[model samples]
Target: MDRATGTTDPGGGTRMTDRLLGVRRCLAAAPADLLLERLGTELARTYGTTETELLQVDYRLAALVPLSGAEPVIGAGTPAWRCFDHQSEVVQGGALHVPVTMRGDRLGVLRLAPVPDDPERRGELAEVATTLAHELVAVRPGTDRYAVGARTRRLTLAAEMQWELLPGRSRIRPSFSLAGQLEPAYAVRGDSFDWADDGQRVWLSTVNGMGEGVTASMLTCLGTNALRNARRAGLELADQASLADQAIYSYHQGIQHLSALLLELDLQTGVVTAVDAGSPRLLVLRGSEVIEQPLDDQFPLGMFDGTLYQSQRFELSVGDRLFVVSDGVPEAASQTARYGETALHRSVRRTRSMAPLEAVRSLLGDLRAFVGSDLVDDAVVVCLDWTGRV
Candidate 1:
């Protein structure tokens, strides 16, 4: 039987059509775990392969965790790492790997073995893997079992609270694309990101509150929601920042404060207005160089009861990329060295040619490799690419 086309799919129709129909039917009937297991088994039998596996990304361990609870999970140095790290299909040895991605976030990799050695054939197999991934993501939003399986250990109260409050892990729109990841994944605190586009303009923000544990996470959540509320009310950048600042100072008093950066991007003109409340800075990449964009200094939310926040505007040229990093990247320390701002600039230079989401994944992979251990602080990187296409 030809690998590309057998007599017929198991569903008694042409190979591609039957495979997709079968997947949709499974989606309508099976739960998350069962769906994954069934898909793996079906792929194995369909392709006459000896082994296949579905692994979800466990960012805490920086490892690929099996959804079926299998042993001997892999990550970092293998093809699974390359597939997700580069956000591209990878064919190496007898293994074929493809990233399970939706929006800008990389969910994990789909792995198969005993596949045809031809590069073109392997690419086709990777497409099948991606289709299966899309099917899984379609059903994943309404369930918690997928999230539960992705974790390697129990989550702390603060981590749980923060995770529940997230608008999403990543987002993609026509005018721009943004991606953010928080770590240690199962025990993060005082770090989060949010963004949305309202046809004409896009709103972006990142927050890192002072202190640790549940209280810190709660404060960040309040601060983030306050900004969202103000934005929804059609407040300008300065007013939105002020509302968040006033809410935190009045409600949490002098003890709690959060450093944040709020951005309003004009979709049509490629102009960006920012409200800087903390140490977070905006860096733009152009032609293999990372240039630091100056942002106005403002008081961190809750620092002063009546602080006035100012908005600083910058114009973006076509294809300019913006990076907003939590203090974690620059402050990170590896076994042999500390990851600093200069090194980060060099990294952006190295990865400048890749798409926004791919550059983000690559940079984060490097950070995890440098840190050696799970990050000690909640490191958040939000990347935005403005093509000025709108």
Candidate 2:
């Protein structure tokens, strides 16, 4: 181990690229339970350091729990948390913390103590973290180690279903950035979000189911998957809503229905076509002003069979930000007032200078502070930023 450089090649003269490739190979071969242990060992061998650990963000976003160690859990304001929050590297007390993210999804952070303050070595460490993140995503389905480490508390059955149904907490692309969060994460029911991009257009949806518990989860599942099926079949925005409406109607027979807000963003022109089917609200922040986009209020999904849906088209400026929220957000009430009337607007305005992912997290945190108790219904917020010129 070289104390000054905090780097080494166990093979004596191995190139950094080759070392990274070897790390990838090891990750591919390791089982889920041993995955992080293998990564730590490889990091120590490739870059001399006293400690190497992976800290995964908890489901509630409150803490970073270590994957394999007796180390204390990390919380906000720490270097590891900052690395995860900013999607960048942080160094403090001669230790390095790098984000472990795949695509736009953030899984956690990689921490290396006593790492030298060198940009080249830091970048290489980032590459190693990225490779580990990709491997974790690929192997997560076969085991529960990562999932178990991500949870600070047990999830309700409905919450588990909703979490599984999510595409991801955030996604980054050339044309746009999108992120979302659900309130009362441990026991959330009914509220869910989905999005897909097929190069030309990005489709986004938010569903607020009618009931609670597993019933609400199933209701949302039906509507969201129906929309996905339609979108995958190459249906446009309105028809996608129509198909989901028909599916929900068939399942509930007018007795149960879910409110949804659907959007399709044209990657080339920055035009957004939307179907506002229920109580969900869409707000746009252009420059410093935040304005609620008023769309024609159509019938909620499953309200009746063959509910003809219409598309409303609007253009987003290159720097515009969009917020799509389920009814749970506006309807969130304290003893004195509803969050929608004033607090929601204020919170949205406060997030104007934030990135899409951080904005979503901040807004949800504000909601939690205002409510100050377990949410009776699920609350969801999705934030999107249009960069144009894809």
Candidate 3:
């Protein structure tokens, strides 16, 4: 370990672990606002890549904007955006664009000019991009630069709470890849999503609270935390829902209720245990066929005291994709009619070739286009692919 940098370099050889630690060393001392600058300096020192740039996906999940507050906005279908969307390296016009991602979260891209075509170099650059992503997640809460760079508009207090409450927009694992997002980014309320993977299983939930604004935000917060508290205590699906239901009921005294869908996927077996408490919707796509995964309807959370919840079991094959959405997506209103079943089914099928992260984004984009304007209510969408790979 270097006493100055607080990072270990086992021998002087240029191993990937050593290089990753070196990047961590640079990040360890970097302030939030200077993380990208420090990363650029480290990359230059180590790889002699001086023209590297960090572009972060904005809050709306639309485009990639430079973290350095510079020019050259990268939009969808461009090299940088394609790199981000596809989560791969793209070389165009003598520049290499690499996706900077942490698990399922699509952060942005790292662009390096005049790079070699060597496989080792590609691996190292990809690792460096991933390392930067992990560091950004750690340093994000401490700095405003990340948030500011990603936002094109101010967030309402409700939207702010909803955004902060999310674990991330996407997650990738050996067994599956999951991605989720909420709509009306600037002022979303009442709708939120959460997930956790503990190697053995992944727990996912979508909450839809009553009303709008801060009141709804707070209600959602209370319900989500209650669910979290139960899950963290090692409770099963039914108990987690039951506890959250009680908490909400106690808080609102039956005056308010929130709908939720809680799912637990066994990573090793592909078995799913679910609890459906009122709103939100679930659909499974298997072999080009879209089917709704049915669950017995129960009272919404907080509807009444001592409401018992039951868990239903199902299984997902390796090639299956599951979509869980709040009512906002299916029920979104247009000038003529609702963005209903036919449109929702078509939209989901349209994204069949894309990744989970891109699928959710495309679905929301379709919703926006169908509505022809900003959404009147909050919407949330989560997509999970069961790869079941060892």
Candidate 4:
């Protein structure tokens, strides 16, 4: 025990502990707008830094919006995006940018300035930023200030409902990587993808529910949840699809339908069993080229009360990829030119070397750009890469 510093070592362990506790203690009391502001202040006081700022990646996919301080646009070819893009810190002359990511979502960048000259403290600074990111994720479900910061425009009720039902935007494991993207972020309806990895298998589904706005969102909700219920109840892949079809048909009756691909994948062996309901062919990317995996197509959900959905089995290699898309991809009109299967496959080949999230972004981003930045209908792209690890 040290006398003056109240710690065993001379590295100010006790002070750091006190500051961490202080930040946690203040977290519960601060309002949304002031949340990061307080964290920055506490960090500055503890680290002897001149200034601290937090920048969030806006939902528009363009600039980095600030929660409290100055708004900094991530200029073209700038290093700022590298912080969020690469999940690594960017250290410069006076300012340092750290990626504040939790799981696979690139939340934003934590920027601190007038950094100390000591190299030994980099880890400590990074830990602080990382902890803050975790705290933000935990608190976000109860508050919308972070969403307020991230949004570029007002979100529609249907888009909000759809987004609320989604899992993490991306997931990465040693044996596999998966990412999903939805377009018309502010107004999308009923286009959703969900997945789960239960050690032995990964369950995946992509659905496009019929109708518009809230009605479409409700139909999607019913379909996705019914599938989840059946799967979680230990039903087979075919049964899961059947249960979803039954639920939607029983409630919505004729005319309300969904195009879907429900799958069960063995994590260790790379085997895929799928039930396609007006679903596009599963595109498998091996090495640099993308190929379509053929499947026996079934009826879309709600098309019939007694549609017999069958499971088709296939095996994937170590580097194989799985792609699932809604009808929006092929139907999306860009200059009166739809995104045909050939172009979509070509785009995947072009972005094969990028990270899973980057690949999804590239695919969706290209589609949006081609359609003049406004997709008339909802579009989704789900990518999965199997690394065949033990």
Order the numbered candidates by lDDT, best leading: 3, 2, 4, 1
**Residue range 1-390, candidate 2, lDDT tens digits:** 343453665647656666778888889888877887887777778777668888887777667888774464565688887888888999997789999899888888888887866577678889988988888888888898889878878999999999999998889988889999887889999999999887778899998988879999999999999999999998888999999999999989989998999999998999999998885889998887889888999999999999999999999999899998877888988788788747788888899878887898788888878888766767888999989868
Better of 2 and 3 by TM-score: 2
Q: List, residue by residue over 25-62, the lDDT tens digit for candidate 3.
A: 89878887787788888888777676888888876787
Pairs clashing in candidate 1? none
Worst 10 residues of 1 by lDDT: 6-15
RMSD values, in order shown? 4.3, 3.4, 4.0, 3.4
lDDT of 4 by residue, 1-390 (tens): 344443354663545456556767666566755678777677677677777777887654567887763655666356568777777778875788888776666778888887766554555677677777777877888788887877767889999888888876777777777888777778889899899987678888998888999999999999999998999899999999999899989997867998889988898999898999887557888888777788898899999888888898999988887877777886788777888877788888887777787787778777877788678888888889888985
Model 3 alpha-carbon miss at residue 31, Å: 2.3
Give the total clashing residue pairs for model 1: 0
lDDT of 1: 0.77
By lDDT, the better pick of 2 and 3 is 3
Clashing pairs in 2: none
- In order of listing, the candidates' clash counts read 0, 0, 3, 0
Candidate 4: the clashing residue pairs are none
As for TM-score, the candidate ahead, 1 or 2, is: 2
lDDT-better candidate, 1 vs 2: 2
Q: Across residues 131-159, which tens digit of lDDT does each residue of candidate 1 receive?
A: 66666677667777677777788999999
